[model samples]
Target: MKILIIEDEEGLRESIAEYFTEAGNICETAASYSMALTKVELYRYDCILLDITLPGGGDGISILKKLKENNYTDGVLIISAKNSLDDRLQGLDLGADDYLVKPFHLSELKARVSAIIRRKMYNGSNLLLFNELSIDLQAKTVKVHDTSVKFTRKEFDLLIYFIANKGKVVSKNAIAEHLWGDGIDIADNFDFIYSHIKNIRKKLVEAGGNDYIEAAYGMGYKFTGK
Candidate 1:
């Protein structure tokens, strides 16, 4: 799962990001409202950790308003030092799924995130199965007909992207944006996209899995599952 931590406290932000990353989740941080806004607008996260008090011009509530206005229905968890009933109620009214009082244990936060993701993405299920392939999201492992399949960081990311957008034609530009973000500007072309896809396909098939990726000519690639 991809997560965005929008907190002003540097130490707390790093601690949260590191904890989540060590648990096999992709995590990013933003110390100010503006930086958090930029990340929220550009990418889709499974969950967002927002802090009510910010260093910049805007607060987390305003950020939540913008996200809702843009139709971002993903799970949002507000982490704040304020323990007032009105504050919690206000955050909930603004569409936040969960609220956590500050100085909480990291384990509790992780549990909340897991619960939110399972509810939103899997209807409370932890396993994702597609044909002969199964992904144990909680365990951070993939298997093909009970046989384990190992994947590198990029390869795992690419596979997850494909599974998430299965049966749809995903363009190379979209893939580049999701995987490398703005870093793609350094590349002259999308040759790296093709290379990664080729390698991923080869590995999956070599693991006794069926090929599901289809070339879309001048467009890009599609995971048809047929």
Candidate 2:
């Protein structure tokens, strides 16, 4: 999943980012409110870990407000040190999916983020079904009919992203940004995207699954699922 960590505490922010990234997630971070706002406005994430207090203009609440104002559906989990009922109520009322009080365990945070993403994408279920495909979100496994198909971390993530947005055209730039955030300095080439898609298609067809992905001419690729 793609995650945005909006916290000003350097140590806490780094720890969260490291934990999420190690679990095969793309993580972007902001040390201040301005940076957080810029990221939320410019990109989308599966979840946003927001801190209520921030330096430089607006606070986390304002960022949450912006997301609601723009009707962004990204799951939000307010990770604030403030454990006051008022703060929690305000965050939830403004549209945060969950609230995690500060001084919490990383495991708990992971669980909350997973739950939010699951609720948003799969209606709170861990299994995702499309045609003959059965995806076990918690196990990070995929099966076609009764045959198990193995996928590398990135391949698996790309597959989930595709299936989640099935039937919609997804641009190469958007895919790249989602997988490797705006921080990475990869060279200006999208051959890697084609290669991954080709691999996915090959694996699915070999496993008696339908070829759901299609290149949309000069635009990008679309998972038609048809």
Best by lDDT: 2
Q: What total of clashing residue pairs does each candidate reach?
A: 0, 0
Instruction: Put down candidate 1 lDDT per residue, 71-112, tens digits, no spaces.
Output: 986689999999999999999999998999989999999999
Global CA lDDT computed for model 1: 0.85
lDDT of 2 by residue, 1-226 (tens): 9999999999999999999999989999999999999999999999999999999988999998999999999999999889999999999999999998889999999999999999999989999988899999989999999999999888999999998898899999888888789655565798888989999999999999999998899889999854
Model 2: lDDT of residue 72: 95
Global fold similarity of model 2 (TM-score) = 0.97
Each prediction's TM-score versus the true structure: 0.86, 0.97
- Candidate 1 — which residues are off by over 4 angstroms? 180-190
In order, the Cα lDDT scores of the candidates are: 0.85, 0.92
